[model samples]
Target chain A: MKRYNEKDTVEMRQVYADTLLELATLDPKVVVLEADLSSAITTTKIKNQLKDRYVNVGIMEAEMIGAAAGLAVAGFKPFIHTFANFATRRVYDQVFLSLAYAKLDAVILGSDAGVTAEHNGGTHMPFEDLSLMRIIPEVTVYEASDATMLAALLKQGYKQPGLTYIRTIRKQAITLYDTSELFETGSKTLRKGTDAAILASGIMVAEALAAAEELAAQDIDVSVVDMYQIKPIDEDAVMEAAETGAIVTAENHNVIGGLGSAVAEVLAEKKPTKMYRIGIREKFGQVGTADWLKQDYGLTKIDIVKAVKHLCSE
Target chain B: MAVHQVKDLSLFAQEIRYYTLKQFVTMGFGHYGGSLSVVETLAVLYGKHLNSTPENKTDPERDYFVLSKGHAGPALYATLFLRGFIAKEWLQTLNQNNTRLPSHPDRNLTPGVDMTTGSLGQGISAATGIALGNRLARRDNWTYVIVGDGELNEGQVWEAVQMASHNKLDHLMVFVDDNKMQLDGPTKDISEPHDYVEKFKSFGCYSKRVDGKSTEAIDQAIEWGKKNKGKPTVIVLDTIKGQGVHVIEAMSNNHHLRPDEETTKKIMRECEALGERIGVST
Candidate 1:
């Protein structure tokens, strides 16, 4: 097991800014587009560093996506960032036709997923963003586990073609891995054990890991995998995990059409793994801090521990 | 400076009508009412003005034509076929199951299509983006977009208007096909805003009202739009729905009513005679 360090204690938003800034420097064609919330989203830092490449289209989400499509047509790679709720819902038409349907290469960074925007209330919390974006045929969806994963994912997003939605969070998350480890797009098994397999993504990966550690003390060895890329899921890894008979799914999004559903889609077809979902139930979140929201939604280390126990009992 | 002789404009209008009828009949029937309304403007834009090629479809530096009122794709599709951007055979498969020419003009599926637009008011916003992009890149290629007068009901259309005016995107030219009809009923019955010309002028656009059927006026509008460099231009084309076919024009719901067999024959007869008059084949 790898020991986590304080060096990985960077905020995902700050990592997102740093990664985009580095990407802009590395590829002259890379451009950043913000929807008036650049400073709030912390992408203004990247804009400040890469002045010529960053574009701040004030408060016009639809127009920003449209302009990004045009920029993509003109041989420039554009990265658009805004709140997760607005990115998928408000400007869906523009993102659908202008980017996805047109097959234009653009990246939309959606921050604050699943009650991450605590005091901002339900309107700000993007509980169903994953479902909205995953419906688009060509979209590649990613939810980062930590700062390092976000940095790596943003780098990968810059190099990738077609539409990809990065479901970014606004808080500093615990580091799950070091930079030396390789991260695949679809599925990557982080822990290998015999009792059952734990499939988790985004902020839930850390909880899943902690739960795995607790379950191991009880003589139940559990496997942990980071299912980062939701669409075009790693079918092979899922099948391998299901071969062990016990399986559990988790994410920072709603249970429906998110990571759990994505895994279930493959498992139902290939191997029937006894699965349990650990996520926000079919309910909207209320105003609260990030820690309180996570606890209220059963998205904690204790929740994961209980879920693993239930799967074992079944 | 190029003047389109009325005879040539009449011929182009007949050709556009012919293709539109063919596409409508092939697809069983689509937004024929809206499609029929924009025939004159589509004729002028694709026939006499826009610089494009059927072969070099992906050329980055070429001028762009976006159909913001994309429900009227049949008119645009007919124009594309006439311009040789797509093979004439492709028209037969329009709106068919798994056809390249779906109800909307998908840029990925169709050649010479600048953007895929079906949702009203989005096409102009995309064209605004293209103009802004061209300006930023310092490219000479201008962008042109056509909107149904009824499509102005969408608020995004005005958002595009403000952006175009504020950015001073002179390379952009917009033609509002003021045929005065939409999905439900007439634009006046549904939600008639203000005088679009004055609305655009107040929004900072260089505005004009033109007899859309006259190719000479359309060409002049194009030249004026090109010569003016600080503000965007909107040419309000006062056209009639089903203008070439008199019977269809007389119908209350010209938007999507299929002409009877006799009416179809009459349209065919009119196109055939017009073709002969212009010395062109259908």
Candidate 2:
């Protein structure tokens, strides 16, 4: 249950592997299916420990998803893993049909979310996975902001039915919460304030929290909420944030149809909140380090803080 | 009760045709083309093969049937009704509001429906999954999935095909209703994956092509599929669109056409004649 240290920077994938290994021991129905990226996602430990429960289905992502569905049908809780790009973009039809369309109790672990696959560049970086998955009728999309929730999401994922997409960033990330943090399938409101609210997800949650701290220094109080769960997004938390005057949405994902779009949709329907979105503008990421890509996409804490001020001023 | 003779198999196909026609008449409109083409295959499975109970519909040990080309739900529903898995009166409520029998077969909603499917190229994957699951569970149940020749155009179908072959899902049998025609004329005109036999064989599957309308041929293919040890079977059914209904048989647009009153009367007459021709009483 202890996902990350209080101030440690650990990849979400480590938590995923730990949770997967734990599930293999506790739940007989738990199975892991990967598409030739077991080594990349750091699930080798899980594969070694739970060999019978894990299946390396070659580089066939679509087949891997189908096999996962098969495992689910056989009364096994199957967690499928691949890069975010391969998991979502390559096998969209499989995810849509074999998993979500059939309403199978399957979890798809999409690692290296957004521009996190930095050196791999545009081909591997999935900018619109959340957007594509959230529109499905029965899919629950979760992107872990840090290691703390990755383990929690994996545990919660097996208990929940239907198709679940867990977007995990593989690189070391700034840990936001202690291991005792109560994380669920829906969004978790991390910080609370009244002057203005900053909604964020994935790695941007750390930036949002840092931005909140900086804003407090400037005498501008800002609330930060971690909208980790994209679909079945914490509507109450979003509505409450809108009630706090201004809202600024930030994410490492694309500006369109990602966390920002999901929150904007909720706000557009309810009380219209004056909000600005801080994410990748309709563009592909270039080859660089994960940190460089995050900065190049204007997903740093400074960007979040600037967006918070702009939305509050407007 | 033992190995069904050719006459009995032919009669069973007629029964399938009769029930399918009746269901379509009840639904007003349905995918008549694909359903009619797969009637013999369904008849052979239900009549000569599949160890299922109409009474104990949820018997976990029973063989499973998944219609990959799920637009043909009317056909499967009709077959299930005739098998006594569902009440005949329920067939009349097809596609109605709050009807369990929607345009597609929903297992959660309907009795004897193994999987919920309507999206093309998906049911096969579920069926493949079911077969794999059964194997994992050490269950003796075999899964049969029917895919349309046109539906094979979907890349996901190939994905399932590859997985099925790779897993050596010998208990799984996939039947392709190679009726040649799709919603847009012919399958070749749309997307051509020529030589499904060779394609499946190359993919490490035991592949065979049989006259889908011939009940005896379909039964033999099913038997062969069942006997195959290390590979799954892909039985390509060479069938005709609008097979049993004469009026629809003549019209190319029968894929979505609902029989008018006059045509319905003619359909009844033709169905009766066809029933007699196949040596079966409706």
Candidate 3:
């Protein structure tokens, strides 16, 4: 029942940059490290304004993570930024040993998750970053559905202890929450219905909402929930959604270890329901627009609608 | 803090090595090559330079130490024990299940173990970050990290190196235990990261190559590193893979050993003889 839009308003990367700058100004302990992708990640403002507080560690994701851990060890909160794929996979060991195992307070901003890598192609697309981060013990894994959610999640990441990974998207996200509404560290209901529910995250959230709108016309009242916090997943909201008895999980990632898998696991365990998944199959990404990539990977609104229909029929 | 005599430093280094070897026997298996190579370095650190103590464990401005080549956890455990940073009861607990001293240095699990390191190259990067943080916090402290030469093969090490130079992390000092051996084989045969001193220089760090066995040389490097500010320092310690007891040093590969009952008895005997040679207070 919030105001919905269909055009690009503002990029999430800019929101990330502004939020970091604001945090730096608020807390002296907040130091940030960039892996030489500041311009691409759009953190130049923080770099320029907070010169002494910022470090550009070149194109080294693992080293950036290591230094972040060190900063945390030395009693300063550190935030590291890089692309999503490199952030989660390439430096996984460092993130594990240096940050998590060390039990340090640090935040990693892994920009460009899933097909949001757009034209950057397969090597850059991080369809499994969520799964990789979720596997780390005590790491608070998060993905933002829109700019508002990202700003609030980042603020929480700054004060939060232990290693935290914020899976960020560089492109503009369809606005999901209102200006007054803030993001919690769990899943939240976006549109309430009773026939079936769509548990979605990241870019798939808008698709899920669109599908909810389409299903409304068919008298199939579908609930759309934004399951943003992936690791410490909102089981309460999940059980609430499962009350409908039919569920469809959607995301811009592979079904193996992403939103689909996470929801499937919880639903199978807590409350068994007839469920369907709408996401990228076991395939790599390619050069295409975000919308095209969604359609190509069978992650569009149509896919969500189909899955919800199937769940309702079953 | 009393300045320990060089003789005391040498004696402490020998005792620490002896303790590590016995711990190996107790634990059944351990990293020997990397541990022995960094004995003198760890000794010079805990025994002389590091302003650390049993009571001052939580001191914020205390000099920080990071063992980047973390397989050498036993050596550090022995040194921490001798330095009063940890209890002697935990010395023989190396690699034991649920023991505070695991195979790798864990910061939270153990007292005075500054950084949790086992994955190579991360510790140095952490030290660099600590150094930068020290400057930002206006905390007067030096951050020392011991990294194996083979561990330098990790690309992240080079990345940290460049960032350290760029950030002017002058309070950070790195000791490269150039034992020339790694998990697979000789570092040259495995993957040669040729000329570390030159590599450090290229990365804009002040570097030196010194005999790792000589405590005086390590002391001098520390003195120089402290005086030279505006850039980080790297002391490349030229060392043998196994250098403590003659028997272990002579073996073709002493990096790790499974001490069967036969080998365990031989090592215990060697520890006794080495103890006597160093004048263990009997």
Give the candidate number with the greatest TM-score.
3
Runs in model 2 with CA error above 4 Å? A1-10, B1-7, B54-56, B189-193, B259-262, B274-282
Of candidates 3 and 2, the better by DockQ: 3
Q: What's model 2's interface RMSD, roughly to a tenth of an angstrom?
A: 2.3
**Model 3 misplacement above 4 A:** A1-3, A6-9, B1-7, B277-282
Query: What is the per-residue lDDT of model 1 for residues A6-113, given as tens digits with 9 covering 90 to 100?
Result: 435678888888888778888877878888888877887676677756777678888788778877776778889999989998999888888899888988889987
Clash pairs, candidate 2, are none
Q: Model 1 misses residue A255 by how many Å?
A: 0.4
Whose lDDT is greatest here?
3
lDDT of 2 by residue, B227-276 (tens): 89989999999999988666887886767877789888887787788667
Task: Give model 3's DockQ, 2 decimals.
Answer: 0.86
Predicted model with the maximum DockQ: 3
Residue-wise C-alpha lDDT for candidate 3, range B154-252, written one tens digit per residue: 887888888899888898999999988887888999897778899899889999899999887888889989998789999999998877767677777
Each model's C-alpha lDDT? 0.81, 0.81, 0.86
Taking all chains together, the TM-score of candidate 2 against the true structure is 0.91
